[model samples]
Target chain A: MSIERLFIANRGEIAVRIIRAAKELGITTIQAYSEGDADMLAVKLADESVCIGPAKATESYLNINGVVAAAIEKSADAVHPGYGFLSESPEFARAIEQAGIKFVGPSADTIERMGDKVAARQAAEAAGVPVVPGSKGRIESVDEAVEVAAKVGYPVMVKAAAGGGGKGIRIAENEDELRTLAPQAQQEAAAAFGDGGLYVERSVKSPRHIEVQIVGDGKKAVHFYERECSLQRRRQKVWEEAGADCLDDQTRENLCMAAVALAESVNYRGAGTLEYLYEESTNEFFFIEMNTRIQVEHPVTEMITGFDLVQEMIRVCGGESLSVSQDQVKKSGHAIEVRLNAEDPFMQFLPWPGKVERLKIPEGEGIRFDHFMYEGYQIPPFYDSLIGKLIVHGKDRTDAISKMATALESLEINGLKTTVPLHKALAKDPGVASGDFHTQWLEPWLEAGNLTPENT
Target chain B: MAQVLSPLPGTFYMKPSPEAALYKNPGDPVAVGDTIGLIEVMKTFIEVKAEFAGTFSAYLAVDGVPVTAGQALAELVV
Candidate 1:
């Protein structure tokens, strides 16, 4: 099947990234955007663009019917949802398929199966993959949740079974907290995911978040090693690195194989991530969840493996086989990515949307900035605060850290406050540099070391 | 004083109970914590309360219309 024109059903740097990849493949690109994003870099960079809907994301980006209409109107052969928004939405995937355009990710059924955390956990368990002890199914009542918690033991996590993003999740140390927190969590989950279904799981305190990147063509799968995304705040990832330095050979191989096994078990296609929680003391890893689309931190994997993952994804969608086998793929130097959001880390990380007054970017060997900012681009408040990602790759962790520090120094955006200073401090921290970090690393580092700019 | 506003984002409904009469109407007296309506977003219903004592003016958002963060739901005559 020839992909004449591809419609990107998302925005930001990811849209631009997909457009560039399509251009390289000699395919015409059609960019879709809401009202506020018409002049975005992706729209300007693509061959053509269409206003999908109003500035409100629900009426626009997440408007499944509108996106399908845009794809149909543009005569696009395939629609690429570049992470977030409707990237993992099975309904959107089905709508694209119904509109006679190929959805550039996993099959719709696979998305549905992997979307619910409970079903996904069951699938992993059935496949012989170790999953954290939790509720066997969705808990419909607070009483049910309490019962499940007692069975699972204390210090359990209450998660919105239908949603993610750290929302609707509460860790209760005892039944009293569980009883109060459970209803609140359920309400929040219902508000966030449109499904109030809750589930219980064993909480892995001080565990490192490691995930393996895998690609499949429906018949076979290959692993691209793993990424360490231990640095996070409020359950959102901030800093990510590829080829975690702390892993020994045995553990690394085990994690990689486990990821591949899980992918094969489900007949997963395209790009997917199998997240795991690694306990340093026991060296045990348990499957957490499977993200059916390309992740926000895909660049780290690309840098370490020298692979254009987006291009590979498009090819896979176009009915091509996996390009590189397990043996052929290589993990090179250390790579790190720090998200540059238009928010002040000190001021509770509130979104600061404004025009870029003076933009000075970091430039040097092994440093790449993936952003859509210019001298006068207005950062819209309607969407996520992530303006760009600053990625640096080097021969080792030390080199990568030093290079990232230099890059952060060279970076300047005068109009809006950013987390650049926060990243800079994190890069220079002894614990971070040595890779002795956990999922709780970033928040405490900011609090204890006074990395917030105001503290200075 | 002017009424503050609803704290959460959702679909605004004027009546508390579907079978009961509306809570407040134009020129009706309201105080802080008085239930103005119900806002349902993603199946979660949150009561929209009057932030201050005032006379009800008009509903800014239509019934069952989805609202977002900080979008006005109603107005009041201080």
Candidate 2:
């Protein structure tokens, strides 16, 4: 099971990170890119590269056959799908395995189970994990939704059962909003995930978003503590930090155990994040969902634990057992990560893609920048605007914030607007610094400043 | 500019499922709304229309091939 050549079915900083990790393990890396990304960092860093298709994500990144053909053409022994795109698709994983190439993630059945929100909920409930009160299956029409909402009580969260990135979720205050928003949510979910399944849950107000990172080998598993990702805009995480400050020791232990139990129940392998909504008042945390791939904020956990998660994932794919026991896991210091996007934060966060004429990255002891940019690199008009991530780790949250502030001040990229100003403002906010924030913290704060429209 | 248009993301069907005539062929003068090809995604069939008045140039992806989003199903000489 010694992998010699590996094909990366992704692009950007995470792809670059995976390439480096593969190179470290004496595995030749083949980087796959879309048309605009042919000259990107991952292409330059890998031992080989291939342009799968044009710049549009659906053709290049999400195309199952195209990615499989690239791996087969390169004669790669394994394929590592970094976060986003087809990372969590069970069909893609099955295709790679059918092509006689090892997929550097979990089993197809495991992915299939965890991918369906209802099935995953059943698994969680079966494992005795605390889950939010919600419907057990997809609601087809408005009547079913109303009936479920009535039983679940008022102020329920209507979610696209097959959705992610907060795209198709609606918070309904009454029966009318639920009925009105259901069709729109279904259409969006159909367009995005190709599934229009809907579900209901009692909306947990003012809960801090906490998730536990776990690495398993289909046999043994261990938890890597928790990350408090309450600082989010539009359900997309803007900032993340390791060792959630609000969690007491008992709560942290319980949360970690819940994550482990959930993983063990499904025999999940590689890196996955078990998300939960933690209510500080009751010290109760309920299982939300599990991301079946490497997370965007994985670097924060890696910073605290001193483990190369990408490399470990590769090793697990090659049939390696769990490298560390539960007792060996330790959370040290603090790390904060911000996604640097080529976006106009003032213009409702619209995509601002162009060329980077001048780029200056930060340099300091605790500042780490994961980016795919250089001077004169064209910020392509296609794909996600996340050009990089600025991750700063320190001995404490205050020190991490100060380092991130300094790093943001020093970092510069011209020829396109970015979310740098927004991150800078967030870092300086007292509420964010004190960790006295909830899931709905960012919108109201930004609206009060007139930074965005009220609905935004 | 000769705008080369193609099908959006969908499954490609060439010969109307072995019972009907082929949609179009090379050198066919197609109007804007002419049915040049059929693409399906998630069990829904959508006709690939020529965005502008053009002559169908070539078929880039073969019939029955699963075309992804932004894939070139056919080249159009506008």
Candidate 3:
């Protein structure tokens, strides 16, 4: 590998994750942290550490110039931006490349293209990937709306071109309903935003969040299969599983191939994910967007495929070709990952950051807890609440869920409130075990007081 | 004289938003349950409400500065 020295441009558990991967690759890891994160675990684990800026992320982790300068000053050969912060910033990638340091992800151009919604949708369509059936643009008349609706199928959602907060929106189950609702929506929109322009889209009912993980060497690409992240609250994934059990073998093959096709079409480099909204009833998947960097749920994919994604991405971005091919990438058992956040799950998921007074992690095969916490560590309240992620692998989905439940029972972090009880309740939920949940399931479940003390 | 303590550990904001005016200025009257400031913890903005009615004296903690739980945020003349 050409990357002899790696600078980690992120913090928290992902920072620790990158350091470990870089160390295993025989590379010196330089951790970049804020003033408040001087005592973070990643700093201690890295071969060297530097403070980029203050506690505020806007002036620190998200500061491209500061991060780039720190990396260059440290004589780093490459920079690895873990998930969040500047991970998907094209400017950051370009700055690193211009500074004669490799960025452990896609090219700046690729990041910019994939970051755009319209551009990415066009790319997906050009690559023969199915996108959510919708109007080409704003429909001027009810006739145009109906024409678009017939092709996209029913039920359809009529939305205002300039609308927010659920205003000027209506759902129609059939043509008759569309005929009635479209004009009403148009009038409402015109009255509200003074723009009667409307658009129609095939409303995906009870959609499940599925994404395929793909890696490329900017020449060829391959997929590591799919992950189901349907369990979400406030649109943030709470629990994720690899090799979505909801998909059949044929559907899984098609979904994975479609992702690889999209990745190859863009000449994508390093790790990327193609998020799709899948409808269970029709077994149809619609491409939504692409994440240009590694994700929080990446470890679940790693657990099932036994592929070190971080190391692989580093190798490829360091001017090396993909070390593994499509056929060589094989997935074994099912794996589930639950995010452990520093929040009081019972109290409206309020953020609770405090010193770690005691720590006890579950230990056994098929169990992995990726975290940056240690005894006496004080978790700073300046960043996101994600403290750790608990992952488990098993022979199948049921077995994985069982292992997760047992692991949650043994895992303990004292002197701080966390979402442990939330995961414990989910692990035992019959709806979760039967895979009968959707992307909108968790919030309503919480609203129904399902995460009570007795449930945990 | 009394002090209004922070209910949580985080960055304290005297205003609702960057462009907004201060919730209470020095010498402003403060009533029970009136919002005095906001404490942003882990990206969640929680309102810091006054528990004791008094005349607002001065802010003990600087705006947009980090503060620990029970830290005096503002002084009040009872």
Candidate 4:
């Protein structure tokens, strides 16, 4: 049941990435695009192309029916949803399954089960993965919240069960604080989402965003180690590194094994990541959630482990077994990846969708830039601002940082304002170089004017 | 007659949301700094404001259509 033709139902740099991987596996690539994306790089590189719908995403990329119809029309053997969009959509996967086309990901049932926060937490607990100690379910009154807070230990986070995007969240240092904040959070939640249910959980102080990359074949699963993505702004990761230096060997082993345990418990398929909140001081990590698809920072894991995750996922989803054993999946060196977005860093990171007049990419043994841009290519403004990702590998973390700094200097994309300057400043910053930061570190660093032109 | 040009190249929306009313209609009064429409660029919405007080004549660009930078979006009679 090997896939002979793979249809990519996404756009941007990831679309180009999938096409390259599919071609390397001797699979014919069919790229689906909207009217505005007809001139995109993936469309030009794929073996065949089809227009799904109009420029609007509702009628195009995000349109499940349109994407599935296009794949069926092209007679694609499998559909590769490159992260975001429909990558984690159970409905899309069901539709593709009903069409009798292979979906290069987990089954629809797995997606649905893991997509729910409460269900995912329960699964993690059943698999012996450590989750944040908290209330079992929604708490009704302030007295119940105080009882849960007493056991979980304060400073605990009082969160609205139905709220998202950091809304209706409050931190309470003690029972008194929880009593006062719980009622407000409940009221806000009821007003915003029509749900007053509350969930209380212990908050990890100065947490680092660490995640383990795992891939499975619906029977067995293995881990590819961990990645640290603590440097973020507005909840979006700006920089990422593989083989978190902050973790000791024993902790890293335990973390990776726990991720595999969960993956195998669900008979997970394709590439997935288990995100965790790692506290350096306590040397403890708690399972946050599992991303049901390949992630944006997957290249860093690939660089260190030397595994083409995309190709492996395609093969396994096509009915092949795990390619490598746990002992055989060895890691070497350190890798760093910085998101290169089409943004004006000096202008408060405003979106800049200018044409790429000229392009000069750094080329070396350890430097790689995954992008979908070319000279004279006008970046479409209707999508995300991520134009590319610059990845560099070296002997160790220090060496990787130095190589990244040099690569940032040589890389150029003319006629467009990018986040290059921001990365340049970060590469040389003392805090980043020492790897002494947390999830809440980047915003304050930016506020202190560390990214000024003169600083870089 | 003066033309209101789009500030960015992206989709143009006459209403804030699909179910919301239009921000401005033909023959409506427009004051300086009044929002006439919105231009969505790379998922970020930027308000297109009237630079001069005038009477709204007509929209030159269709709603929910792609527009280029500095393209005429609407007409205003000063």
Candidate 5:
């Protein structure tokens, strides 16, 4: 059931990514855009374009009714949410299905179940995936949280049952802080998500954030190995690479198998990621949460596995089964991805959205700039600040790092500040060059005044 | 005539909610920090506060229209 026309219900780099994938499948593309983004790269590249609403994401991208109406009016057979905005929203998926259009993602029920961090944790544990030890279930009150904290030891993380993107999170070091923070966290969760339920989990100190990429055909699943997303600033990823060199072969296989097992347990369909917090000191990894969409760092995995994940997702949604078996999946070379955001890292990473007066994208073999920026294109102050993703591949990690360093040095943009300066500093930093940094390393390094122009 | 321009890129709203009445209208008097409208973006609705006090003139942009930063939102007669 290959769709005749695919409606892209997102914007920016992901929109461009989906359009390229759909065009390869001979499917006509209809790109949905806000008034401010009518001239976006995807809109210009798609077979057709539709103005969904005003510039605001809520009125355009996040408006389920608006998106569904566009799909129906344009006779689009399938809708691709890409990532972010409404990609993980169960209600949005249901709206698309109710309109008799394919959602190009998992079923609504699956999205809902996996969306709740607590429920996803329960699901992973039930599937025999190793999870960090903490409260047996949702804690009822501060007393219960204190009791759980006592058993789990100090330094427990209080998380909202329905949280995402690191919201409703608190780290309590001892009984006093737990008693003080549990109720405060509950109130905040109640205000934010309308769910006062809370859970406690043991915090992995200086953990390296890694995730396994899995794609399923609604029956079976296969993993494309893992990506190390440990270089983070303010708990957000800046640098990512596939097939990390830290883990032993045994550990890597075990981790990947655990991810696939979780995918099977959920009967997941389409592309998803199983995130983990790996503590290299103890050689142990704990399941954190599952992202129910193609992630931003997916290109690194694609470079290693030689699979077009977006295309694979579309094919699976079109009723095509898994085309390759586990044995057929191969990992080769090394790949690294750096997120280039239009923000001033020196000004606390504040958004610096404006026009790109000059743009000179890097060019070389194994260098890919998955971006949507062009000369004179206005970078709206609304929406995500990510201007592009710079991905590079090489024969080995050192080769990849050297290539990436060179690529970062050669990259140029004007009229707006970006994280390029910070990345340039990071590429030459000894810790990052040697891959010795942990998830919490970047912030302290920045706090040490390492990102100043003079520092670089 | 001084124009109250939108300070950011978003949808300009005359009402707090669709069913709510317009926050201000032509011929209405306004003051500094008075919320003349709301600009919606990224799911956050920020109040388009008046930076100058004056007699409220007609709105330059239609309600619910997308407006770029520095684009005139409403006209003010000082």
Candidate 6:
């Protein structure tokens, strides 16, 4: 059934994006927010708004019951969970399903199955996809872990079975390190996800973080190419680009086909992403994990393909078939995106929340700024430091690099520190311009005191 | 003497809600695991539980103000 009223179970820029997409489809938008987000742009733009609870995420955004209540109370026919918060929560999706409300995402079963990293690994193996060889499933005891480690060899990664978004993972170079780090990783997983299940995987050295975007209708699915997400800091993406300048045509096609194969194997519905780690030395890629939600850097893919993915997800959820097939999807030019965070990059990326006294957004061809910030926008000190995204498109990687650097220079956000300076340095870096950086490249570079203005 | 530490960063709350009674007050008897206040961040509320049995002496953090991790929310005297 088509959505009549759509409730956005999230805040920030993604909320605004979903509202626009739903409104474009002639559906009324309902916004759910915390007390601190009452005055945010999403609440202001929605057809109706509700303050689910206080500013604390648990009482509001992360509270499945509260979000469901808001959707039901608003008479929303469907709920769109944006990224982060409870977006990946299978329990939340199940609650929405049990409430007899449509979720603009995969089924609760799909989320539950894919959310567990170990289960997803097993599923990938069943689908004939290449996964980093490790424990057969979640390892329970230290002896079991050691046994698996002996088989998998050293330099293994201990991961939270249910973890994603780049946290709750640790790498051990030797058996001793694994024995010492496994329990610590388990405790962290227990505290973060309330699940202490741990698994081991062979660690790929300096791998390129490549992710393929997939959309499907349960029985079939298509790929939207892939994004080069290797340039990261703290295992969190700082820069993203559509298509890897490093991959050959054959390799690119194979990677996208591999992603589509996995999605089709699961009979996946809605939009999902399969992340892979490509070993540069071997030119072989192994499945990392899948993110069962829309991503922050989706703009780069959108730019390259000219597809409004948020709209696509909404329409597909409303029983519409994907407008295009795998053959119909086309990519053009190159696109790059950088996160503009309200943080002091020089000071260990410390959050610098404050009101923007002045803002000068760059405006030019191939430049897109995705943000909800305006001058005097009081970035509440209580949430993620990401304030906006700067996405740029060009004929090729080099053009995109220059255009992004120009865009960063033109963007002048005053009254608070930001990672704009860092982005500028990254854009001008010879390695980044040549697309030579890897997943673990940016952090040590930052610690090496490479963020100075002259460094650019 | 003892202190109640905020487990996470957020605005401190003395009571469960404005209409609800305060969790603890000065001169109130408290036990280990007693919730002296609430600390909320990222839309999550975590209880600031007492570590040792004591008489609650004072609220170190102002009510409804931002408190960071390990910030003392309250003081206690044995």
DockQ for each of the predicted structures, in order? Answer: 0.08, 0.05, 0.84, 0.92, 0.31, 0.17
What local distance difference test score does each model get?
0.85, 0.84, 0.94, 0.95, 0.89, 0.86
Name the best candidate (by TM-score). Answer: 3
Task: List, residue by residue over A1-456, the lDDT tens digit for candidate 1.
Answer: 857799999999999899988999999999999986877899889999999997668899999999999899999999999999999999999988777788889899999998998789888888777888888879899999889888877888999989678999899999999999999999999999899999898777789999999998888889999999999998889999998887898999988988888788888888999999998876778898999999889999999999989988888888888888999889889999999988777766655666799999888888888988888987766677798999999998898988898899889998888888888778777888778889977777767756855432
Runs in model 2 deviating more than 4 A are: A134-201, A450-456, B1-78
Task: Write model 6 residue lDDT over A160-226, tens digit each, in one string.
Answer: 9888855579999898998898888888888888988888978888889999999987778999999
Q: How far does residue A105 in candidate 5 sit from its true spot (Å)?
A: 1.0
lDDT of 6 by residue, B1-78 (tens): 888887755689999998998898789999998989986543446677888999999998988877767788899998
lDDT of candidate 2 over A273-389, digit per residue (tens): 999998777677889899989998999998888888889889988888988889998878999999988778887776666679998888978788888888888765556668889
Overlapping backbone residue pairs in candidate 1 total 0
lDDT of 5 by residue, A1-456 (tens): 778899999999999999999999899999999987878899999999999998767788889889899999999999998999999999999998888899888989999999998799899999889889987777768898888888877789999987776767999989999888888899988889999889998878789998999999888899999999998876779999998888899999999999999999988889999999998877889999999998899999999999999999999887789887899999999999999998788877766777899998899999999999889998876687898999999999999988998998889898888989887888788888788978888888888888878744
Q: Candidate 1 — what's its lDDT? A: 0.85
Determine the TM-score of chain B of model 2.
Answer: 0.79
**Ranking of candidates on TM-score, top first:** 3, 4, 5, 6, 1, 2
TM-score of chain A of 5: 0.89
Native interface contacts kept by each candidate, as a fraction: 0.00, 0.00, 0.69, 0.88, 0.27, 0.19
| Proportion of true contacts reproduced by candidate 6 | 0.19
Candidate 3 Cα misplacement greater than 4 A, ranges? none
Q: What is the DockQ of candidate 5?
A: 0.31
Higher-TM-score candidate of 1 and 5: 5
lDDT of 5: 0.89
